[model samples]
Structures are given as C-alpha cells and as structure tokens.
Target: MGDDVDRIKSRLDVVDIVGDYVKLTRSGRNYKGLCPFHEEKTPSFYVSQERQSWHCFGCGKGGDIFSFVMEKEGLSFPEALSLLARRAGIEIESYRRSDGSGKKTLFDIMEEACSLFRTCMNGDQGSVPRGYLDRRMIPPQVRSSFELGWSPPSWSFMVQYIKKKGISLKDAERCGLVLRGNRGPYDRFRGRVIFPIRDITGRLVAFGGRIVDGDGAKYLNSPETEIYSKRRTLYLIDKAKGAIRNGGHSIIVEGYMDALRLHMEGYPQTVATLGTALTEDQATILKRLADEVFICYDADQAGQTAAIRGMYVLQQAGLSVKVVALPEGKDPDDLLRSDGGKARFNDCLKEALPLVEHHIKLLSPAIKDDRTRKSAIHDLLEGLSNIDVTDVSPYLPSLAALLGIRDFEVLDALERVRSKRRKTDRSFDTEEIPSSLPDEGQQSQEMPPLPEIALISLLWSECDLRRKCDTREVVELLSDPRLKLMASSIMMGESPSSLEKRWLEMGETFQLRVLARGGAYLDEFTQNSDWKWRHFCHLLYRQKGQMRYNELRVKMLKGEATTREIREMEDLRQKLVSQKGS
Candidate 1:
C-alpha cells in the first residue's frame, strides 16, 4: 500500500486529473472552475497549491488522484493504481519473486493472459481464427491490428500451456482464465475465438470469446469478475478512443463484429458493448471520449430497447445520442453483408435521428392518447432533462423545434424539472428543511438539470486544456471531493519533476487518450471563462441545510475566517469526518 501510494503520488497530478474533466483557471494559490462532477453555473472546482490535491464546492466526491481515475473512468482500485504508477515510471514487481520474493498482482496475471492469447493468434496455428475473420468479412489489417484470435478447443490449451509457461494455477484462476473445480482447473474460454478486451490504458483486463462451434450462445463473453464488468467496457475502446476524440463523435454499434467491421471499413471511431444492452457505465465511457454518440442497432425490437436504453444513458452523460435506424432489422454487420452494404450503412448514419426524434418514433402511437401520452412524453422529457443541454447547443434549434416549442420553453421546462429535482438529488442532504418543507418525494427523485450539462460535460474534457495557468491558490480553497480527486490527478502530475518521463512510461497511445480527452476540455475551458465558483458555494451551503451559523463565535475564536473561508472549512471538515465515520 505504501508503494502504491508513493507511486501514485509521484505520477498522478491534480492539474492533469482535474483538468482532464474540469476547466480550471489559476487564481492565487489554486485553480478554480465549474465543478465537473456535478452541475453548477460558477467555478467551484479548484486545484491546490501543491498541485497534489483538489476540492470542489459543489459535489463532495473527493479522494486522492487514483480515486479520480477509478471513479470517473469506472476502473478498479488496482487498475487505477497501475495506470498512474506506470505514468510515474514506477513499475511494481511483487516483493515475493521466484525465491518467494518478486510477486505479481491480479493485474499482472491478466496482462500475461492477454499476451499469451495474442501469441497464439500470431502463431502458425492462428490461421484458423484468421480464416474465421476473413470469412466474417473483416479486413486483415484490422484483424492483425486488433490481435483477433481463437482459443484452441482443448480444455488444456491455455491451462496446460500457461502452467508450462511458469504461471501458478492460482494466478491463472485469479486472472479469470481457468476455473478450479473439485477435480482440477478448466479453461474459462474453451473452443472459442478470443478477442482480448483492453481498457483505455491498453491494459488487458478482460476477454470476449466467441464460440467456434457457431452454436449455443454464438458469443460467450467474459463474466464480471473482480477485474471485468460488462457495464464498464466498450469492445474496442483502446483503438477507437483516438478516432472518437478527433471526430468529436463516436459510433456505438451492436456486437464485436460490428465494431470490428466498422473500424476495418474506415469508420475507426466505432465501438460496441459485448453483445449486450448498453449500460449507463458504458455510456459514461463513450461520453468521456466524445460529445456526440451515434448509435446503430439492429432495427428490431431488442435493438429499439437497447437504443432507448443507450439514448437515456448517453443523453444523461451529456452526449448527443443520435439513433441510426437500419432498415429491415439489419445491424451494422448485416448491412455490411448485404449488397452495397457499406453505402447503406453510411446512408443510415447520415440519416440518423436526434434522440428526440428517435424517442418520438419509439413512443409515438403509444403516446397518442392524452393521459398516457403525457406520461410517455414526460418520461422522455425527463430523460432529455438529464442531458447536458450544453451538448445540445449545436442541435438546440432543431431540438427546440422537435420539442414542439422554442428553445427557451424547453429550457424553462427543464429548469422547472431540475429545480424540483435539486430538492431530491440524494446527492444533497435536506435535513434542515424542517417540517415546513413539503416532502415532494414524488417529484424530487428526478435527475440533475440537463440544460447546464455543458458544464457537466466539461468534466470529460478536462484532459484537453490548451493553456495551463498557475491555479495553485484556487485549487487550495475548494472543498468538494470530485474536484479534489480530479484536481490531484491533473494538477499534481503536471508539477512533478519529470512530466515527460512519467508520460513516456504510460506509452504513446495512452498518453494521447488521457491528453486528448483532457486537452479538448482545457481548450473549451480557456474559451468559456464562464466560471462557476459562486454557484458551487451555493450548492455547498445548501447541502449543509443553508445553516444558521455560529459563524460569529467561531470566526471570533478562529480570528480570521471570511464567511466564504469559514463555511468552506467547516464543510470540508464535516465531509472528512463523515467519510471517516462511514
């Protein structure tokens, strides 16, 4: 643990971390800006003097730099640790080695498994899966670049081979490769073509195996173990992140084939869940890459359900989710298979419907009735209300038109819903409201405001800052957790003695993804100057029941707490205490 902390500290910077998701401005000893983790109209996100920490006045999600990556990116603790550790050029080998000295963690074993899978795919025997790829119509360049492979059907292929290669059965099991039963360990992915799934950092954390028999489940995916979760991964993120970032958009399709084929066919920015419905977590990942997401699903019922789910999640994350409705129940793969497949796919993409239109189409006739219709339309409006309306800027006129009203009306309705929503975000405590406050529990459960999601969307772009300002003093004064975690990772990393050394360690590709995401955001921040500091203070004060203070006595005793300073210190201190309690 000490080693991990040391490594993360040396590597991760609060500036780069906070900057990756929040636009910041240097003010005195810290950097200040809108809280990226929560919505606000003023700059509250701050990066500290030491550049080792950050805090926000609005959202309370704070922690060390590693926690920032872990939460915002949906990565596990060890994964975050390894990522930042690598960035710092600190490679961790186990204290216990061959002589019971050099040890490896769960992440190490997973990496080894991924490599072994890759080796098999590159070998002479790999021709089978390679042939399979060809049969599937994927280009060879894409095939090799993706390292697509097949796991030999034999139960002992990976198990026996890996053990022979010096891995302990325990390590293999921990990596989710071979499962140990009463008799012995059996390979998890037997008789299947294997596709290694890597996180954005390019680490091999999971696998997606397709049945070679062309039977049963067609595709058998890796189950969520300690290391892998379907909700948190996109099939081709490692390759597609750059494409998505540059395009300011992404193509989310159904199945591994669609992602692979699309990338192979010039659309390198495409990605997909592993043959499953899109999840909120997945949408979060996509949104982190680009401001817009174009979804292409099979035009079937299941596809619609998946599309709707994607729309809600992507929208909630502040991405403009446009639905590309394929004709005749065809998926991207199906289109690529048909005559003039690529053209048809491109046409559909060009004709993609904004989420509002898609929602209308999905719930149209069903919502034709007056009463039930309101509920249905309202359901979609609520979803729309969750979107970062800032993302809707380009499409606002169209969106407003589609909302069947003007932009202000849509904005007004969204504000009303959001206003009522703030009272219930559970993100804030309202114990002080007393009995006088109506328990609008029924109406308050709504999501946060969407209109201001532009600020929210900035979190995903923090890594993209174009110009760096000295924000040392401002980051110091903030008290929000989300800000702190993000700040630590972004700011601290930048202040380290050897920034390039640390970055070089993470590999060029990774360095680019982190920078690309944050870089774009940083650019936007410098341009907006649309700070959100005071708004954040408002949220913080409100969270504490807009307290009637013993401010006079405390400030007198403390001898120097400005109202802002006193309130902030109290808020942060309470948070630290509560965290310890929890």
Candidate 2:
C-alpha cells in the first residue's frame, strides 16, 4: 500500500492537481489563488511546489494531495487513495477489506450499464434512436463523442444481460439500473435515447433517458443511487470544466439537448442542470471553476423562473451572474437549429444582462399599481441584500433611483435585512456553546498586541528564518490560545516537512488566523531577514516586560509585593517607556 502511494505521489504534482480546480498564479516561491474551500475577496490560498503541499490562509484547510482530494471530493482516505492511484495510472494492490470493494461496486455497475447502452445503440435495434438523432440534426461525430446510446423496449433485456455478465441482480437494482417486478427484474430505461451523466472526473455515475417511441413520460432519469446524486451532479461538467477554465466563465443551459446544442455550436463551456432547479452543490462547483456564470435557459416562463433562481444561487456563491435572453418561445436547441443560429446566439450572449438588471426587467411588467410596485421594490432590495457583492457603492445609487428613495435609505434597508438575517442565522445555531465570545477568565484581559500576530505568521511561514529565532520563548509570549497551541506544537518538535501537513494538524481557529493575518511580516522578512529577526526579538521582550508589569500591579493591588519585586517592576516599566520614546 505504501509503495502504491509513493508511486502515485511521484507521478502527480501538487500544483497540477490543485491547479485543475483553482486558477493559481506564481507568488514568490509558491503559488497563490483564491481559496476554494470558502468565499473570500482576496487570494489567501498558497501552494508550495518545493514542499508539494497546499494551505489556505483564509479557511485554514491545507494538506497533501491525498487530503486535498479527499476534502474536495468528500471521499475517505482509502477512497481518495484508490481514485488518485487510478488517475496516476498505478494499479492498486488488492489486499484491502471487502468494504472498499463494495463502495466501487455501484460505480462499476454504472459503467457496465453505460457500455451496454452504447452497444445496443450501435446495433440493429438502434434504428429508432438513430432516426430521432438524425431528426435532431446531431452529427455522427457529436453522437460518438457524447457516447449517446439507446435502450430497446423490452422487459428483462438489460437484467438478463447483467445476469449473463455475472453481475448479481441485487447489485444491479442497487445501482438503479433495473427494477424488480412480480415476474422478474426489468430495465428502468426502455425505448429511450440514453444520455450518460458522468461526474467532474469523467466517471460514469448515472443516466438520463429521453423517450423516443413511448406513451409514458417524455423523460426519465436514473433513480438516486450510492454513486449518483441528482442535486449534486451537473450534466457534461467533466467535458465542460476545461472549456470553462479557458473561457473564464460558464454558460448554464436547461436541458441535455440545450447543453449539447451549445457545444455543437462551438460553445463547449456549457453545462445543463439536468432538468432540476439550480442547487447549492452545483453552484459551488461552478464558483470553484469560474468567477462568472451565464444562464441561457429557454425563453418560456418556467425557464425564466429557473434562470432567476439560478442567478440568485450563483450570486450567493460569489459568482458574477448574467442572464442570456433568447428569442420568444425558443430554447438553445431550437435557436441553434434555426437560420444563422450560431450568429444569433453569439449576439444574445454578447448582450446578456447582469443578473440585477435582468431581474428588474423581469419584475417591471407587474409594477403597474402602487402596491405591486412597492412589493417589487421590496423583493429587489431583498435580493440585493443577499448578494455577496464587494462594492455596493456602484449599485446603491442605481437601486435608490429605481425605487425613488434616498441612497442612505437604501443602505439602511439593506442593513436592516442583513441584520435580521444574522439574527435568524444565529438563532438556528446548533453548537452547545457560543464560540465567538471570549472565555470567562479572559473577560478582564485584553488581547495580545498586533505585532504578536505578525511574529506568529512570520515564524510559521519562513523556515530558515524561524530556525534563527528563540521559538520557545516566542510561543510562551503568544496571548492567543490557538496561536500559542500551534507555536507550542512547533516548539515541541512536532513539525512536518510539508507545511500543508502541519496546517492540517493545527486546529481550525489557528489555521484561519494564520491565513487571515500570518503574512503581516512577509514584506519585512523578504526585504531583510536580519531586520525581521531583530524586530521579533524586540516585540517579544516588550511583551515580556508588559506581562511582568501587569503581574506586579496585581500584587501591589493585593498589598503583597516585596520591595525587590517593586524595584524590578519599576526598572522594567522604565525600560519599556524609554524604548517607546526612542
């Protein structure tokens, strides 16, 4: 197992694995990017190529490639090991327990189902599916690339095929590929063209079947299984992620055909929500890839509603959202099939309205009466308040003018909404105790000076420089308990060569503070390591003097200070005073 891990690590680069998920830029000896684990305005995440590690100063989630993948993909260590090993082309030694194999069983079944669907689509029984595709104007190359498939109209056909392949009937049912009936098991998809849905890593996990010659519902999707989640999965993300990264934006469509049509028309940065409302999971995935999103749903009421909801979700996830308005009564598929379709589509995309503007237009028609206009304005204000916008100055004036209110009034309304949300959010807290409040013993004490924060960041980040300083005394002087704990661990020789590994072992509070304030001494340290070392020494001694003075003052208050203690305290206080004057 260790050998497989070593081989995988040797083949894979930390930058390569993380860069695929984030847009990292070179910074000094490391790489920096906006942290993917949380929403932040500035870049606080750093990746060190030399150490082969990554850390986020903002959220404080850092680790090796294995831990990073495990957190990002929500997999266990063993699962991440298997996944990364496969990606690195290192076959795993199968000495594991049966539970690990059980987890991959459903994924294997899903893959086999996709293979069967593809084989059946290319055979003689695929005539109907082929005719449907021909009518839809999908070329041979597009069909082959997407692996479009067909399922024949017959009960027990797929079940028998899986049984013949030595797959258990229970396992097939577990994957939602077949349903057990009174007589026997039957395929869930029949007489439909299959659109295989893969995860972001291109692993087949589910299917969306559109009926071609049936009297039932027009569309059907595989039931939620261990390997497939409708809310978390976005169709074609595996293929679209690269294009999205290159384009610096993502275009979300409504259906599978709409997404496929956009790709066919040279817009490969498009994905579909697979006929569901936009979900937080999907929005989060999009936000990690690009900062901007364009919603190109159909031009009907339902589509417009979905676009508005999606815009809200994306904006809440800190994405810059725009709404592309298609011609009346036309979807992306319909528009792409029309005359000069690609040109018209490009024009629409170029004219896509910002989400806020599009939302105003959407509500304009209902603002005829005073009551309706007031309600519309209220809704718009509520939406604006929910947005994770950095500079509301540019938006506030326009919003005030639109509502015929003063700018300050608009600000007040927004603050009111936000304040109420904060209160409500706090009310729903499930933690046994409030965390942000200081401890009872700390109520009378002030926090350590800000220079201590800078010193901590410096020692934690710079290795060679930290080796020159008195790390033990510095740890003892830290007032913040979390920082003290982290520094103490380092002082006790629990340091890992990889900074990311060290960060992962630190408490969450410590990690966040490091990311938020750790780089305070970066400029000074880089400009002159000697000056930084002297600066830390000066600050550490000053803190020590202040602590001693405080201790003497308390003893004096209790009338228990001896003459020698009083004289020493006075000397320490004078030294601090002279240093401050200098």
Highest TM-score, which number? 2
**Residue-level lDDT tens digits of model 2 in 72-177:** 8777777788777766778785333356346566777787888888888889998889889999998878888999998899877898899888988898888888
Which run of 10 residues does model 1 get worst, by summed lDDT?
443-452
Window of ten residues with lowest summed lDDT in model 2: 440-449
Candidate 2 vs. true structure, TM-score: 0.69
Candidate 1 lDDT over residue span 433-541, tens digit each: 5566435562232223221223223432444331342344334433443343434445554632254466568653333333333333344443443354334334444
lDDT of model number 1: 0.64
List the global CA lDDT of all models: 0.64, 0.77
Off by over 4 Å in 2: 1-13, 19-25, 33-45, 48-101, 182-184, 369-379, 388-436, 439-582
Angstrom error of the Cα, residue 257, model 1: value is 1.1
Q: Cα miss at 123, model 2 (Å)?
A: 0.9
For residue 48, what is the lDDT in candidate 1? 83
Error of 1 at 444 (Å): 26
